[model samples]
Target: MESGQGLGELIPPLADSDYYLDHYDDLSCIITQGLSGKIIVNGQPYEEEMLALNNISLAELSNLINYMNSQWYPDKIEVNLNTIKAQLANCAD
Candidate 1:
């Protein structure tokens, strides 16, 4: 878990569900578990220690996705507008 470690490298194996659930926040836990599932489904060797980090359930990911979609659209628009404004200012000078 050092700075700049890739996320896939930090995920725990499917066997360590309890450990993962205890440490991470709900959203992070869900994403981590989802990633772990992907690894397991793909037949990769899932790490065990990393499982001590996040244990999010399937229902939670659905809730998180809905929440994120609600929040993301407005923020995306604002960011695009700001970027355009900044570019326009740069061109003006």
Candidate 2:
């Protein structure tokens, strides 16, 4: 539930105000395909390549998403299996 702890200030924090507000929709892609280069989180820049987490099952991912949303965001966003599958299908390499 705690955010703002990256890899020695290299990688961006997974949860942040600007990130959850702006790139919330990209969560599926980021989880499936990983993210590289720089991204702005809470007005600060972070540069690193987060490894893909595609090995986990859809159920696990859905549960993780739900937990994260409940902990970080104001509104609850329940992620279903179908939604996760659909979003993952559209992920870019």
Candidate 3:
């Protein structure tokens, strides 16, 4: 997906990563919780403090929740699930 790159080109490079190859939960964390905060995302900066990770979009949130439910991480799951769930639940149906 890189500039001027084909799908095959991308796969070969990423094939070396253990994080990419296994530990699929790591991606879930990155997608759900994101890599950083300070940047406003999903109305999070105004809503509340998110420690380091400040935002994830609603679609991303949905993916994350589903991912969490699918994979079992025991004690390491959900660093910010409560806040996200609270915000989402308050949304109009």
The most accurate candidate by lDDT is 2
Q: Evaluated with TM-score, which candidate comes out highest?
A: 2
Residue pairs in collision within model 1: 12-50, 12-51, 13-47, 19-52, 20-54
Name model 3 segments beyond 4 Å from true. Answer: 1-52, 73-93
lDDT of each: 0.37, 0.73, 0.41
Model 1 segments more than 4 A misplaced: 1-30, 33-53, 74-93
Per-residue accuracy of model 2 over 1-93 as CA lDDT, tens digit each: 266355546766556567865766667777777778887787788777789887888898888778778777748568799888887777765
Clashes of 3: 0
RMSD values for the candidates in order, in angstroms, are 16.1, 2.2, 12.8
Higher-scoring candidate on TM-score, 2 or 3: 2
Model 2 regions lying over 4 Å from their true place: 1-8
lDDT of 3 at 69: 41
Q: Tens digits of per-residue lDDT for model 1 on 10-68?
A: 55333323433342234343344333343341344454443432354444544543444
